[model samples]
Target: MPARYCQDSPDAIASCVLEDMVLLYHRPSGQTHMAIAPVPEILATLDDGAALTAGELLGQLAQLYDLGEPEEALPLVEAHLAELAALGLVRIA
Candidate 1:
């Protein structure tokens, strides 16, 4: 099975959209993160806290944005998720 990822606690994070960027405030770590494009979309899709594989995330994201090809976006999504995990915005499940 593919690895799954989930967002951190909803209460632990606050976010706002500024133009094309999303600013995320993580209460636990007292860190502010600036995200753009797919990063914001990825976090929004995981707002429900449901663990999802890269492919699953891509599917959801495709519905919200114009992602041309799932095959091409899978790797990019995975990379974003990994980065989010490192930033404490998400975790591997």
Candidate 2:
């Protein structure tokens, strides 16, 4: 399943995410929130653009997975990111 996640980077970044759908969330408080949705739903939100990175997706995945630090989240994110990339939901660059 496309997992829910949350992350707070030292510097806020904008990105997009998809599991079942596409969603968008910016680090308003340097914190990013995310959840799983459908690809079409996400595409609707992405009418503005295509392509999303881990930081762009919004839900509660990071927290859901217990990924705490960039050091920690990096690996976990890499795993999920690869999963998303495989599904064509995200691009690493």
What's the lDDT of the predicted structure labeled candidate 1? 0.89
Separately for all candidates shown, the number of backbone clashes (residues 3 or more apart, or on different chains) is 0, 23
Highest lDDT model number: 1
Candidate 1, residues 7-92, lDDT tens digits: the string is 87778779998988889998999999999988878988888989999999999888878998778888899999999999999999
Go through the candidates in order and give each one's C-alpha lDDT: 0.89, 0.43
Q: Clashing residue pairs in candidate 1, if any? A: none
Q: What is the lDDT of residue 32 in candidate 1?
A: 96
Per-residue lDDT tens digits for candidate 2, residues 1-93, read 334332333223354655453344444544344545333333333334434444444233443344456665555554665654454444343
Best by TM-score: 1
TM-score per candidate: 0.94, 0.31
